[model samples]
Target: MDLFWRYGFATLPVLVFVSFYRMGDVLTLTLSHPLWNARGYSLEAISMADGAVALFASMAGVAIGGWIAARWRMGWALVIGALASAIGNWVFAWLWDTPLADGSLYLAAGIDQFGHGLAGAVFVVYLSMLVNPRYPAAQYAFLSGFAFLLPRLVAGASGTIQKVIGYDGFFVMSGALSLAAVILLPVVLRARSRPSDQPEPAA
Candidate 1:
């Protein structure tokens, strides 16, 4: 605990990852049902868009991300996933109120799902990498626990944010927060490359 407190900045990638993941969750949870109701999309249409199109696309994206993670560094994968997520959210936000052909909503949902799928897989890998191998169990538990809790806590504010900014503005904020992950990529790569980056055993 003392060591972690002293070198907190070394945890940049994980913190950013949590933020990115939460933003995506907030966007999905806070708006999807309400948006469907406002847009007059039947529950069946919503099911198709979320359950079918998004689900399949997300699965495909995870597979692709797994392959890419094998071939490339985790940090790069994170950057790509973050950008894709941001773009996907932006696309949905842009199309929120526009008249949609039967296929358009599915496309938007698919894009968002694919981005999230990619990011989700890579995020776990990245957090694992950031933990000290010597204290793998405890460090991982700490990081993972904090990562999970903080995001959900902040996400609880989505309702309040939606009331203040409205859906479009809320979505735009989500996308923007996701993009903040991109800024930490260089730091992640730098930390990974350092000769002393190896994790030390817990005292």
Candidate 2:
């Protein structure tokens, strides 16, 4: 109904953040093999670095992010995640050709995986807060669907974008995309924090 759509519309900023965030994620993930090959890395080395190390780092990040969000504000946690993701992407792209490039790549990949874990945890929290408690299941299902829906569509073009820009440029673009979430976070937080108006009790 219109109400459902309107409720979804109220969370437009979050949706925008999700779209940009996931698009960048998809781009990085989709092109990682090609990027590693270009960097003269063997498949086994790439698997060891990006697979095992990144996985463990991501688990740590998820735990740390969840702890921080529990201790501080979720909005601030999301900000931190965005900053980490952006910086990680920048590092990966910038250090791709310098000395110790393999080490640099591992470090950047770990940082990026951490950022992803953090952001993912915080995103679920955001959805929980946004959904109506009375209809938790239905509302969450609707909103959660909306969260990844547009992002999937936008991420479909990552191949074309990567082809046009190359790996370094693509990574930088991914980092740059996170800025939209940074700019919009404060607005979304403020809107979410506002209290609904209630009629005063009769004397």
**Could you give the C-alpha RMSD of every candidate to the true structure, in order shown?**
3.8, 4.7
TM-score of 1: 0.81
Give the Å error, residue 188, model 2: 1.1
Residues 1-203 of candidate 1: C-alpha lDDT, one tens digit per residue: 53255346665564655655546645665576676677677778788988989889999878887777777877677777777777777766766767866577788788888887877777767767766555678877876676667557767787898789877787788888877867766765675323345466478
Candidate 2 residue lDDT tens string, 1-203: 32244444446675666566544555566666677777786667777778888999889878987887788787788787777667666666765655645676677678878877877677677777776555578877876777667657656777788789867888898878765577777666765433323445588
Residue 104 in model 2: shift from native, Å?
Answer: 2.9
Q: Rate the local accuracy (lDDT) of all candidates.
A: 0.70, 0.69
Model 2, residue pairs in steric clash: none
For lDDT, the strongest prediction is 1
* Best TM-score among the predictions, by candidate number: 2
**What lDDT would candidate 1 get against the real structure?**
0.70
Alpha-carbon deviation at 145 in model 2, angstroms = 3.1
**Candidate 2 to native Cα RMSD, angstroms:** 4.7
